[model samples]
Target: MTHYRSFVALGDSFTEGLNDPAADDRGGAPDRFRGWADRVAERLAALDPEFRYANLAVRGKLIDQIVAEQVPLAVGMRPDLVSFCAGGNDLLRPGSDPDRMAKKLAGAVRDLRATGAEVLLFTGVDPRDTPIMRRARGTFAIFYLHVRSIADLYGCRLVDQWSMQGLRDWRAWSDDRLHMNEEGHRMVAAKVCDVLGVPTEDDWRMSWPPRERVDPRVKRREDVQWVRSHLGPWVVRRLRGRSSGDDLDPKRPDLKPFG
Candidate 1:
């Protein structure tokens, strides 16, 4: 198997491991989403004691921002491998241009690959299981294909999250219906490792037991609650032209040795 002694990940919340809180996150400046990148790092470190990993992902960054900021730092680090996940937040907005974003991302991939490092890119997941996410599925699918085109053009090994069968269950999502929970992140990590040809333990395809039936009225009530807690706040943020990553720096900014 090919060995990657150093790894660096960059992108938004999904790459940052959102909603998947760390087990022993000491009180810190910003929240930690112990995402799939960290898990993959751990596995890599276990195989090679000299392994080092860095994740330069922040929450709510657009493709242009990620390209402008994270790409340079990642290229400078010169890691043997780089994983990038971006452009989802842009698609989440109404009428966000997919071609321009795909071009920006392709440029980043081109630059990163010029450093002679292996590049890994991911596609947007199929969120049709979530009612709100389903509404934008058509638009998001176009974005997904744009990414696919970039991956193909750049010769990047793509992690097709949209094709993941395990994500069909609603339980794979967090309370916000946007980010994935711990289990979903784990499955993603496994999928990444599978793509990278790294060994893993658990079966990511394992789904939860059947859910009990819920009354239509109860489901409607939960939908209202979801709006109050998650959707409403997101809309407010969008309206204000603010991002969750605003005023926040990447959690693991430096590329260094890992545990």
Candidate 2:
């Protein structure tokens, strides 16, 4: 069996467990403070009494920020096992540059690999089928594919989080219609355990619930309105010689793409 003395997780909100409702109820409150990475750590501890784990994920963090902050912290930990779940926020807005995102992801992988840690990279689910969530899914797929290719290039293990349970079944998500709920968190924890060769209880099995479908026309109108409110001015300004890069300094922490 594969042996890892310590585990570390690095990435963004999905990695941090943003939408899990159960996190508030749990004594440790990982969902609010921890994330999927912390949940995976909890599962690992349950499987092996001796396993040690730490989560370094932060909410709303992009690949570049992770590399600059979390990557060094993870390297310092000298963990044997490491997993990363990111790229969701990168897909939130339409016309966000995929090539730039991919480049930043590649840097993150390379930096982590330099620490000599065995890394597991997770690709997020495609949200295309969801009426209001469709546009971002296309961009998500592109980002995921590129990250997978980067993992292959770096000889890292790739976890197919997008294909895991709860993605196809919308009921796994929370009432907000974006984040995953308690059941969703459990499913994610189970999948990470499987990838790490950790044993889990039978109760860990996930069930897909019926999804609510919305009218495509309504979703389209909503998308148009969202874009007009968020990206319209930015696009117009870019066309008029005010570039996005210029308007929002890359170094500014609050300059992320608004959904």
Candidate 3:
């Protein structure tokens, strides 16, 4: 496995760490915030303090926007390693074309790889596992398959996030049914380390313990609340042509020596 001295992450909310709030005050950029990429960077920095990292992901970015904005910035950084996650938001758009999105993503991968970075890519997860995303399961699958094709064509390292059975488990997600929780992010970090030959203390594929089931009535109420809190706003945004990342800046914009 190559020991990356410099790394930069690109894509969306999943890579931004979202609900997985940062825990440690490590000078490491990824660790200054909590997210799978940050966790991975934390472990890599531990192995080699010379490692430096940056995260350029913002929530709700579309594939074309990522290619147009983040790709150039990442190429400029010229990190030895780049982990990219995109297309999820695009796939969710109404009347989205999976092939077109995939093509744009492939182009982005090509540009980023031209900078001589070992680009890593991820596929969208199964929507059937989430109540909110269920309506778009078919679309997500189309996007996911194209990602696989792009990975093969470009020789980019592919982390088949969709194949991770553990991710389907509700424990791997938050109530929003979109982003992963802190525990889920940690699991993903461990998985990425395992993929890149970084040693980990435990397996990320472990299943959740069985627990008593919640009442069906409570589940219904939770669903109603989710529609009100998350889905309703999402609809409004679509209607108003706005995005979650409309005014958001990259969480960690520069790559510097990490603790």
Candidate 4:
């Protein structure tokens, strides 16, 4: 069994734990967003009281930004384990090339692995049922293929989100239909533990209950609301060349004892 004395997580909002707010559900600050990385760190801490953890993630960052900003910091920390997940923002942009993005990510992975740390990479979640995301399933698939290949070549642990069938359910996602909800984060934490050979009481692969069909009219109304509340703002930001993380900083910049 491999044990990690320290873990550093890097990437965008997913690593930062965006929609999966902590119990208090406060609006500002990074601690309010306790995500899968935090949960996984908690599990690791249980095994070793001296475990140290750091999360250098900011919301709305593209892969290039992560590589340029977070990658060097994480490498300098020289943790026993590193979790890297980025590029979703790049894929969402118009005319973005999956192959190019994959190349960038592969470079970052190579650097992390060079430190002799056990690196963990994540595949983009399967978006077959998601509305706007479903259209770009091919892009996501192409990127994931490269990710899988990179992990194999570099001898890294992979948490294949695409194979997590339970995640296909709408309930598993936040209302934005982009980031995962608390339940979804919980499941991913267990999956990460499973991949890392960490023991946890929770079962990540339990089948979800049968889903009840939604009325077509209600679904249509919901779609309209989502477009107005979420999509509209997203488009505006894209046009303005602005990012949500423009003024934000990494929540946990230093490796510290965590539980």
Which one is best on TM-score? 4
Q: What TM-score goes with each of the models?
A: 0.95, 0.72, 0.93, 0.95
Q: In model 4, how large is the Cα lDDT of residue 192?
A: 95
Worst 10 residues of 4 by lDDT: 23-32
Report the C-alpha lDDT of model 2 over 145-250, residue by residue, as the tens digit. 9878988999888878767655567566664455676667777777777776776662334665555788999878867875776457645764585423232221
TM-score of 4: 0.95
User: Per-model C-alpha lDDT, please?
Assistant: 0.87, 0.66, 0.85, 0.91
Poorest lDDT segment (10 consecutive residues) of candidate 1:
23-32
After superposition, candidate 4 runs with Cα above 4 Å error? 24-31
Badly placed stretches (over 4 Å) of model 2 are: 21-35, 47-50, 202-205, 209-259
Angstrom error of the Cα, residue 255, model 4: value is 0.6
Error of 1 at 55 (Å): 0.6
Q: Rank the candidates by TM-score, best first.
A: 4, 1, 3, 2
Error of 3 at 107 (Å): 0.9
Worst 10 residues of 2 by lDDT: 250-259
Winner by lDDT between candidate 4 and candidate 1 = 4
lDDT of 2 at 162: 66
Per residue, candidate 3 scores C-alpha lDDT tens digits across 1-259 of: 6688998999989998877876565553534347899888888898887999999999989888888989899999999999999888877777889888888888889998899998988886778867656898888888888888888898888888777788888887777888898888888887888778888785778788886899999989999999999999998998999998899999889988764
TM-score-best of 2 and 3: 3
Residue 237's lDDT in candidate 2: 61
What lDDT is reached at residue 58 by model 3?
94
State residue 145's C-alpha deviation in candidate 3, in Å. 1.3
